[model samples]
Target: MLREYYKFLGNRLIDWSQTIAIQAGDRYVLNFENDDQVRQFMSVLSEFNGIHNFYLMTERSGPNALAFDIDPDSHMQLVVVSTVEVTPDYLVNLRNRIGQQQGVWENTALLFVSNKVLDSINSGAKDIGRQGGPFNTGALKRNVQATVDKSEKLSKDDKDVLKFMVKTIYDGEQELTLMDFADVYGIIEKGELSDSDYIQMGYFQDQDLATYSSKEERLAENHADYVNISLAHGFGDVRSRITKIVDGEKLISDLSGNNWQSVNYKQILAGKERLKQNKKISLVYDAEIMQGINEDMLIWDHPKGTSKAGQRTRYIIVFNDKHQNKLTVKFPFDATVQDKWITQSKINHKHYTVGTHKNQLVVDFSDLKTNEPESVKVRYRHHDIGSLGFTFNILILPFTDNKILGLRPYYRVKVKGEKKANLEIPSDMDELILGSGIQSNKLNVDKTSQLDNLMLGPNDQLKADLSQLSLDDDNESFTVTLGSVPLNFNVFDNDDNKIQPRVL
Candidate 1:
């Protein structure tokens, strides 16, 4: 009875056998004596994981050979007889080759699929759905007919198969079967396909299956790798043009030809960021200093008076005999000297005109009477009027002699009711006397005169008799009398002249 049942089951399996072809390299004949065979075949399908394994299995088993397994529950029953057609090893190699080529085939496949869909819609194929079963023969036929009706560029047969393939593999509208891919291979072998068509079909299948709204946008995204590789290789003209655009040397409209459409969007965006950083660095190094004296040395005309705290005093000596004293004052770029004049009325001043020598201001002081003291205030303005400004004061003294006195020493003293005052003496005079009047204590007539202390008020007057005080050639000493009680006052020489004055 069991033998008879096995025979019956084998007959049923042969009757139920069917040839299935889903894609180019995947074709198999599935036979099942019963439902048990189908279950057994599905259980081991995962073991055939790669095309290499599938190829080896097909080669070992002849075209009509049946692969069977025993059912454990019913040890006598033949489980399965599955036969797959021989898939060429070259197909596996071709898949690997396409993968190595990266996005080349994927982009081509996309273009071909897009073209077919467009052609189908243009031919008034209204019933063609966007998605359907993996092997929708009706949709495939409509796509093929649409291409044929729209253009006569390709043969009807070639258009039919290529359109079917691109839709199956790229658009995922249908399953890509081994037989269909094999048909592609046959078409390629006959050289029936165009160069562009073969190039598109030869590339690897893209798993993403992403879609784009426009052809230009698709090209920019898909062909970015190709464009970059081309630029890297030797497309100097395109690279130069792109570089010019990135550097702001050229505009987008100046890209020339359709090269702009092919440019990688990511690279352009990155280039713009680099340009922004470069501009920031450029501003740091090349920024303008707003037309004024920004440096303290330039403003004060001395390295010592660089502090911004208070005004400084500068002394100028001019000879009485109409000898011109040229003072060269340096200022920042674009600064103008507005007006300079002496404040004293008794001195005869020259009508001075400010002149520039090597971008420095030159002021001349002349035509002044001897022993007539004057104060000159120079008012200058910068290019930017909104910025803060400073005032500089000059004490001008006219002397009778033309000898180079070499910077005479002056003593700064604080007087009553006056903040500060300077007392300057002749360099040749070694002895100085101070009193209410010149007493008769002279060894020689002209050298025995008394020198007034020039006190600011009677409250702080010095009533002491003639007292000789010696000062070093390079050092300063001070004497102060507060109602006949003399106190030591603070003084400074040229080395430490920046010390602030203390109250007496």
Candidate 2:
């Protein structure tokens, strides 16, 4: 028998294992094989040495047992000495739940375990030691990038912060205060240096810089291409008036006198073709790999026409920025709208949700039934859109590796509480596509062109043109089936640190 925080045995103790966790202040029963060590512990605790709340537990289901609750946050520390030989019944728990205060942290925790317990844990190859935070590669990388990006020009404080970040990346334990960094950069003084002197300057403003981390989320929404065309004539008043007055069919003959006829027609035709091609191509966005978003996702249907000839299509999603990781179809929910349009899924399937919300770009494959269908039902709920006048628009384009790199995403964001433009930040990884490092496929581009010409919707101009000539004597209604699902995304409340990412 020996004094230990965890109990020895009972009908319930058989489930105890060496790696199991035990919370403090839990009542446990300690069954004794011998009584001497128990008496010694009692004598040591009985000295009235301010052990205020000790209860002698005797409600054992068997003959010999001892049990009690150890008060948590107890100012006094209790040392449990073991005296029993190793037996199958004898067990020790490794995961002791200790209280930790937020923001403030304690290091140098002491864990005492019997050699037998260590041996058991080693046999299972389970190490009880693991740490979190500041060590996640992507998190740390984004944090570092944010810190570095904030300073277009570095202040002494910024430089010091940079040095601290490098040190922490390679080393295990590193701690530095603002003063320590300031001193290293020679911003410290011994003479009449006053804190209020540079209080409004860069150093003072960057005090909370260490805590500033970019929301490294892939944007949830897909990107739409924006095109603006301008037509102007700079000829004499008579020529300009004539150019403006040119009628549609007569305009060609009217402008033929000038050299602008063929060139303008070519440009107009090109623009029209480009516009048509742009509409057929589309992008779907997802998040980074191994960031705890979606675990495994696949392109269920390659963008292709149902025709026997498998015409492929090329497409791309432009990100707000470029990134290193693979753009996984699986992305975290809240991160789906972080202004990053980098990660995207190509939409070749007939029925799919493709578009961006305020912070989310969603491509839903849930309601898809067959591969033959063409037009998809798009639905959404946007955030803070009315006041700021944010409307959902889409841009479809041919996918290529170059498109991923050229992705420059922007949004018209208006702030709350003020009737002016609000804070603007660069798109996140999901804001745009990085490199389409995936093997190039010409299929995506070809398929887009082929489908755009297919005339997908019922009664749509395109559909009407492509509709087969009906020869039936009786009128039969043509029915088109559309798939839809409720698209719901909870607004990410920054005030609450509880961030939940959903994988679709």
Candidate 3:
């Protein structure tokens, strides 16, 4: 019976076609067919000289077994061995169980398997084995593809990390650390690096440099156009000098003027006609394509960065067809007496009155003249903005001479605490038509536009606009709906390690 058991164990190691005669004091055999059998064999082996040294073996036929030397490194006169057929699930479970008490058997990489197993694995194919011995490309591809595909369902930062991972894997990289992987796969060309790669690299270090580089590359691609416009804040109240210039009226006295009457009437008529021009401005922001912030994050604030104060600046840059003499501007929120305004000379004219209708700032430029550049600057304190960041939305309520040439919003932001504020400019700034700006700005301070401080204050702003201008809208004030971008975050640490925050 002992010899029969020995043969059974040997058969697990060798093919059933092969035979071996059991010799006394030479090879001892044990049966391990299931979890109970494995435990029983371990118990018996532990009793005799201890199962100190063992080598694991695998087979394609679904049998896994172990061979042991009671006294390894010594000339052992007795060898203990066992084998059993196991399904894929069983082998996985067995490995996990062994790992649980692997103190003595850890770091053992030596594995021996039957020629049939090797042949079956290859089916006589030599490419995968030759390129990298025993690598399962199919398994690798599926594992990697699954990870990347799943990441698409996550926030933008995760997709960036996965993009870097996918790019590395596609290059047959052994690791995600670019430095280490570069040694094996060779350095990547600057031109070949994707936007995602730069973003992922930024999280690990030199984020400003990464951001600048990504922006440069994007510009080079010519996939879209970009613009930057700087809007400043004024310290005093809205200019109150009041006057209404009607048809053929003049603000400047023309004592030496020649035929000023006809010129004044033409200007007024032309301005009215320009305001009547038809304009088309659709929201250029695509919530599906644009990346957003992730909610959960572990912040490593810059030494000079501060915590938790938030404020938003909305920019409205309008260009009419050099026609109208005055354009009325309205604020969605009430401008407290404390709020300051820095705008164009005409829009800030003494005639402009900052009134409260429905508790919001309403500026009427009745005496305003046509085709002068203008913007609104409202500086106020804000709170309750979560870590993900804030959003600025523009909804066009139909109004007259409402031809929106092009909108290039330069976002100005002030975080809770910090010495100097930062600016977040989008690479793509197109114009928005009725009720919508062509582009939506997502001011997430974690990935593409992170600042030194945890919260933003007055100085953080968007300072650029697209060059193209001119969309015509004949509708009255308050006719359109505005849309914002998707929201969430994906972040990482300095060692190029992906950071996944724990949710409470």
Candidate 4:
């Protein structure tokens, strides 16, 4: 079973051996060193029909050793080199192969390193735990804290000045974070701070003599000054956008008519609304508008036996300047559209001017000081006749030249009468790379592919490339029909399976 499970995994599988000393009821460890033997040893665990009588556990024994155990009440352990990199691809394949067991198995453990450590490994930061250099701010702060805490009794003002002086030192021309205090506390508890590191500390201490001030006064002054700096740095606009979203002053446009089943349509719309309201959700600001459906193009087939009722699917596109409204953006011509009116809710009384210019949708909200975030909905009938299968393209465009991260695309389809529709996203489509500065492959979902987080520039364009849909034929007419559920902004929380914001 193990061999077959890994048959498609290819070169990632290594070589191994089973210990000869096996006792009664004792599981053996399949020790791996090379490629061929590991392949042969894995064959011992194969059960062929995707059914396994046993399960596996992964362990990180050392910096170089990785191992897996198949304690099936009938089997053994498979140990491999610790030196192999624990890559994102490796983690994904391992999860898929483990096959979730029946009920919770407490003994089974999943071992992996944090992304920071993985990044360090990739960047060749091999010194492990060296300090005192420009990069070791944690160590520097610890030294400074020790010097301040052990010094002869000083005035409250002097201590505050010392602390601030140390902060400015380790912060190195950048903004200081809360962790500076936390790390100092950690070092103090561990007794890692000492007098030798106090030489430079004394210099900063002497410098503090001229700057001594009460903490309250310094914080108050800094707070007021930083507010202005933040505004100059774009926080003002962000605050405005967030205020609108939180107050629900924004408009939520929805359309429902034509062949769409009411229940399914409502459910899909509800999901989108939830996503939009999710507080943790992060949106790509300055999204580049792309060519969507060309006006009233024909898409989707009608129910087999019904008359040709045209397609009038709804489309809702949301825009938000995550940087808080510091950025202003005009509606992409593709979204500034005029078509059938369904419903528009100016819930918060947020005024908007919408119209069409030169055959494209045109919307203006600049007068309101809102730009980064915008949501538009338009419903229109497609001119094409119905068909069994359909193909469409999903375009991704970024509006700014800055490196944009975490841009993913998701889609949901609903049928009027059917509770669940069979949908498939083919693997043949071109691949997309997400941001995060890593080349991890995008996740493959229920038939569709994840719009993997992408790093795009103002002029860059990434396409879901193509979407091929095959809907289940309606039993009544034996015809396959397709419907669109405007892309909802909601994401599901993995822990409770409840709808929640996509936490960044």
Query: Which is the leading candidate under lDDT?
Result: 1
Better of 3 and 4 by TM-score: 4
Better of 2 and 3 by TM-score: 3
Sum up the clashes in candidate 4.
Answer: 32
The list of candidate 3 runs beyond 4 A from truth reads 1-311, 318-324, 333-348, 380-504
TM-scores of the candidates are 0.21, 0.14, 0.17, 0.18
Q: 377-474 in candidate 2: lDDT tens per residue? A: 12222221111111222212112224223222222121222111121212121221222334322212111122222212222211111122222223
Task: Give the winner by TM-score.
Answer: 1
Query: What's the true lDDT of residue 262 in model 1?
Result: 41
After TM-score superposition, the amount by which residue 226's alpha carbon in candidate 4 deviates from its true location, in angstroms, is 76
| lDDT tens digits, residue span 291-312, model 4 | 2332212112111111222112
Q: By TM-score, how accurate is candidate 3?
A: 0.17
To one decimal, what is the Cα RMSD in angstroms of model 4 from the true structure?
A: 30.1
- RMSD to the true structure for each prediction, in A, is 26.6, 30.8, 29.0, 30.1
- TM-score ranking from best candidate downward: 1, 4, 3, 2
What does the lDDT come to for candidate 2? 0.27
Q: For candidate 2, give the lDDT of residue 90.
A: 33
